[model samples]
Target: MTGPLITDWSAVSPYGIGRAAFEEGFRSGRTTSVPLENEDWLVGERADTEACLVPGFVIKEVLGKKGTRAMDRVTGLVVTTVGRLLDTTGGPLPSEDPDEDTALVLGTTHGSHKSMVDITRDTLTDEKPYYINTAHIPNAIGNASAGMCAIWYGLKGPNATIAAGRNSGIATLNYGRRLLATGRARTVLCGAAEEYTTDRSWLEWHTRGADETGTVLGEGCAMVQLRAPAADGRGDDDALAEVLGVSSGITGPDGVAAGLETVVGNALRRAGIGREEVWAVSASAPAGEAGRQELKALDALFGDLDPLTLGRPGQIGDTGAATSAFQVVATLTAAQDSARAAGRVAVLTSVDRDGALGCALLRMR
Candidate 1:
């Protein structure tokens, strides 16, 4: 270990949007998700829309027309969520220090869905492609969101994005922690962000993982400000969560059990802990059989401890790449506030298509 890793970190989730909301959702023991109204239609599958969606929060109305046009909805969420995290971290508190060595690593499966859809529609509808939003199209690149975040904060440091399906978020966190331990950066603002609305149906069809299993169209952001212990004025004892170790493995579809086991085993070994050490497990609960199988695997891992789901989050739908990231963030927030939370570690796990499994073990405060 080059130095003491992240000693303190907070979370931001859609359950309530802030710390207070996170508390209410966790305290009530119910994570509630709302349904979508004006959904986008899936192009080749069943024609009509059938999943829950997030409310349409007019982007221009909030970010203003000028600042708004530079990004699509997916990108907007990353910028806005990361911005809020930075604000809570330093700007909101006079005691907080602005860390100049912060790095931004984003995890995304698809970026700029809204703009991509717009461009496709423009191309088919008009004889001339002049009507397409060329500016927005250019910004649709996967690295666009991560780059915008770095530029916004004037952070002249390592900025990268990882996309490995449902495990992208966890992989991104692993990347950040490795960088921190190697002395590549002082701190890292990291997590996953993906926009999956019914309105953006084509995106859903191409990347959708078993829709009948209730993959609610989810689109939003989850970001964490991770800093090295002893950075500026932050104390090592003040660590909110510790990054012990991380691992990822590829599995064939038939190797679901083996895939998950391979990653989880590697992560635990890296952390130097056993399955019993994990207090809570944040799962990627989709729906029906897939969701059931996921839970059974967890039951085998920690037989006694109950692995709970964020009630509303599941109902609203699986957040694709952001699935495990949101679960880890939301669970950490809850564990931090509850007095009964005694375990020093939490296990983050996820399984994506094509036999890919990712896992990370985080040591807690």
Candidate 2:
């Protein structure tokens, strides 16, 4: 069966806010990393002092003062990104009611590590153990960002948040496809968001442990509006692309290349497309050995195909859970610019540290 169609999308990224900014930055081929000037984002003296941050993204300033007193960075990014997407569709805003058949799915490593850590710290350091701030309690949960998006936008359909590290975006797309296939909803806002925070920076520093070139963490959100296939087969005229198939797998550290190869092959087979038909490829070029393994796998699979290869991490830094979604957006942007990219397949592959790997195929319209 044909997959769901991506009709609209948007982003609040480090290059700047909105889809136009992201597209321009991507086309210019410039890196978004800048010296970390926000002292609040610094954890320890040795923490990496550089990152990719969305410019002028203060929560209260962006979303207004009401209902944002306790909003965390991740939630703000999600809310803003989704709102921008809805605006592009010329659909109803939060002030006006949205379609009841519209659902939402957001992917992230965790809701807000900073909020969780701060809440825990407050509980321990306060005069009494229960004296922690009650306003922060909700933002500390893993599903807070996704839940807040639904509540903020008045999206009343099935809402969900997926936490699969760097592969979360692809997982989210697959989940949205399933929702449409099952008639769970008519439209699904599928996306992912990640935040740069002191606690999160420290966690990554410890996780990487002494890599000479430290991981440059970044913050942003990217979302796409997915609609169920049209009965009259006329939706393709308005679609950015058709979700062909998605496949995932798990493997040990040493099996990265083989694992990716397995998933990509499976995904293409499910899409009923030959490998040679692929016109472009997007890779989650994570840092270190895993990244090397991922590249090796892609090279082995499509080296002879000579498809256009797109890598976003070199420009946007490591966005964690939002990486895959950004990859999807990047693919769509490139496909729109190149006549050769239309009517061809594009493949996206990702690998996470915890043995998770996934691949997705999209047929550009």
In model 2, how large is the Cα lDDT of residue 120? 94
* Superposed Cα RMSD, model 2: 2.4
TM-score of 1: 0.82
Model 2, C-alpha of 231: deviation from truth (Å): 1.6
lDDT scores in order: 0.63, 0.87
In model 1, how large is the Cα lDDT of residue 69? 60
Q: Candidate 2 — number of clashing residue pairs? A: 0
Please give, for residues 1-365, the per-residue lDDT of candidate 1 as tens digits: 42235443333444534445545654666434453333343233332245433344445653456555656666666766776676632121222333467788888886666666667888889888777767777666778888776665566568998887778878887888777878888878778877654445555555555544334455556777676666564446655676677788876565566567667877787667976666767666655445555566666776576644333333335677777677667667766665645546777777675456777777667
Residue 334 lDDT (model 1): 60
* Residue range 1-365, candidate 2, lDDT tens digits: 66899998999999888999999988888888888765453555536688888987888778888888888999999989998998832222363665689899999998899999999999899999999989999999999988887777778889999999999999999999999989999999999999988788887887783442667888899999998778878646889999999999997555999989999999988788998789998999888777888889999999899999987543888999999999999999999888888889999999887789999899999
Return the lDDT, model 2, position 8.
88
For every candidate in turn, the CA RMSD to the true structure comes to 4.7, 2.4
